[model samples]
Target: MHTIASWRRLLAEFLGTALLVTAVVGSGIMASRLSPNDVGLQLLENSVATAFALSALILTFGPISGAHFNPVVSAADWFLGRRTGTGLPGRDLAGYAAAQTTGAIAGSVLANLMFDLAPVTFASKERSAGNLWLGEIVATAGLLLLIFALGRSGRAAVAPAAVGAYIGAAYWFTSSTSFANPAVTIGRAFTDTFAGIAPASVPGFVIAQLAGLLIGVGLLLAFYPDAGRSADDIVVAHPIDQAAHRP
Candidate 1:
């Protein structure tokens, strides 16, 4: 039985993820449609637009939902003590994965119609095997670390921008095209837009992202020491610092 707040948080996740996939997949579809000479300029345009839209979207919905949009991120948050209440145990991730998959499919369906997307195509499989796996690892790790730094430090106010900026940057630098998001990647499978990953590849991507998340968790413990976790968090910092410096 979920408390009211927890249920709201869950619904928020659903809504936020749907919106996120819409922007990402929709942009991909539109870009591909404009050019028939392969994914040349289209991919470049797709990358830039996606980075901006995703950054804004996360910023908009992050506060209300933590804007997870990906299961691995939530798991890391759980371990970091940022997420409360019960989470799906390891064996029960199927239910959570199902929820994410369903949400992603619904989102992609809506975007397809809204953008008038064309028939799906498995074109330009841009990533290499080694690069693909490594991209997932680094991308997820970057996103988690960015989230944890801003969130756990009580600086959650800037979380949306911080998260968005990170994804945007990863898009440019990361080889696997930053499929840091498990939900978005799954949602993308149903569409043959500029943004889609081959449906067959989803499982491998998820595994890599999860491994990256675990590695991030390990690093988080080392980077952010517990002994220094102050009560001032954000809540207690503001007025105290003002008072301390007061003459």
Candidate 2:
């Protein structure tokens, strides 16, 4: 288990989230420009870049903060932790969420600057639709399921590849292109690029994601009732105490 300081954990979350969003928005912009006439190509490029970046980031920071770059993931961790007294406390959960939100915004601004776009433009691309909302629900539920299931089972060592692979696959399968993360959804809104979601569309997407989270949790508890019984019970090990176990 990690015994790192609180400040360091928060820093890891912030930096990791920022970099993830940066890759998301930056790649979207580049893909759009490079394949202006091919929407499929644009999505292909963006999804590939995001998958690779996310895998690398998770592996790099998982030992420090569990690499929870999304609010839903943090919240889920806190919820599950409460069950066995091994997850984050309320205060830490709030901190992680706040840091993720802030980092996401900063990452969007950074992506804009990198692409020579306005640093604070609000996205105008509206992505509201019943089908898309359903996609969000499916996307987020699958994500949480994968995460907690990996923890419940004894396969956390494969999380980086597994999670990244799932996200990559979800990108192609979901109608909303799987903006399964609330923070990333918000961050993408800061840029009016191909990957951007209009600010107006943010609330609905977030709600759907949350709803999905709840369903995922319910499913996890039902299927893996003994999962996450304690920090030690987790096979993969959350970053909460990964450092403590390090040699």
Candidate 3:
């Protein structure tokens, strides 16, 4: 693969992240306004739609951008030895986070304006602590493990689909509906849109995700000795995590 510049990668990151968050938040707003009773089904619908769209977009753009789209996922990728170049540069990581964050904010804000779902300062809100914590742990662990398993298997080629699939399932499996990315979590805070987490609650979710991702990446590495090595050094494809092999 020809090495694309940081600028191109950043553009891809911004657009991809924006698209994912917009669809999620936008769908949420629509669902809420449409029917309170169908909200449960709406959540599932939005998650699946987002996941499938993300999978396709990521696959289409992964070659140019690494398709991180999420700051938490990018940080995990950093620890797991995945990057276009050595580390994608510390500066680039900061840029990617900034772009992802900005895009998510724009996504939420746009959705709010489009749908009239702006959050009022005085509005009573629920952030769901117990469910959110469980979500953070489950979402983070699943994301990191998917990356690890895919990468070690030499399936970096299919990261988009694998990642999207993991996320799609996470919404169903976890509570709090899986705010898997810090950027998305923060972005969603500005809106009362669908899938939005209260601004006051963002910190806990981020901490949980970071902790889970860090530990999960390490655990993922231990699944295979050679698998942990740089992709340049490995030849095998699609190695499964031994942890996943356990009952």
Weakest lDDT window of 10 consecutive positions for candidate 2: 230-239
lDDT tens digits by residue: candidate 2, 1-247? 3466888879988999999999989999999999999999999999999999998988888877778888898887778777667766667888988888899999999999999988988999999998999999999999988988887776788888888888889999999899898988988899999889999999999999999999988988899776556433222354445555688
TM-score result, candidate 3: 0.83
lDDT of 2 at 224: 79
Q: What pairs collide in candidate 3? A: 28-194, 153-237, 153-238, 153-239
Which 10 consecutive positions of candidate 3 have the poorest summed lDDT? 232-241
lDDT of 1 by residue, 27-65 (tens): 777777776577767767677776677667566555444
Better of 1 and 3 by lDDT: 3
Ranking by TM-score: 2, 3, 1
Alpha-carbon RMSD, each predicted model = 7.3, 2.5, 8.1
TM-score of 2: 0.93
- Global lDDT of each model? 0.64, 0.85, 0.70
Cα misplacement distance, residue 173 of candidate 3 (Å): 1.0
Report the lDDT of model 1 for residue 184: 77
Question: Native-vs-model 2 lDDT?
Answer: 0.85
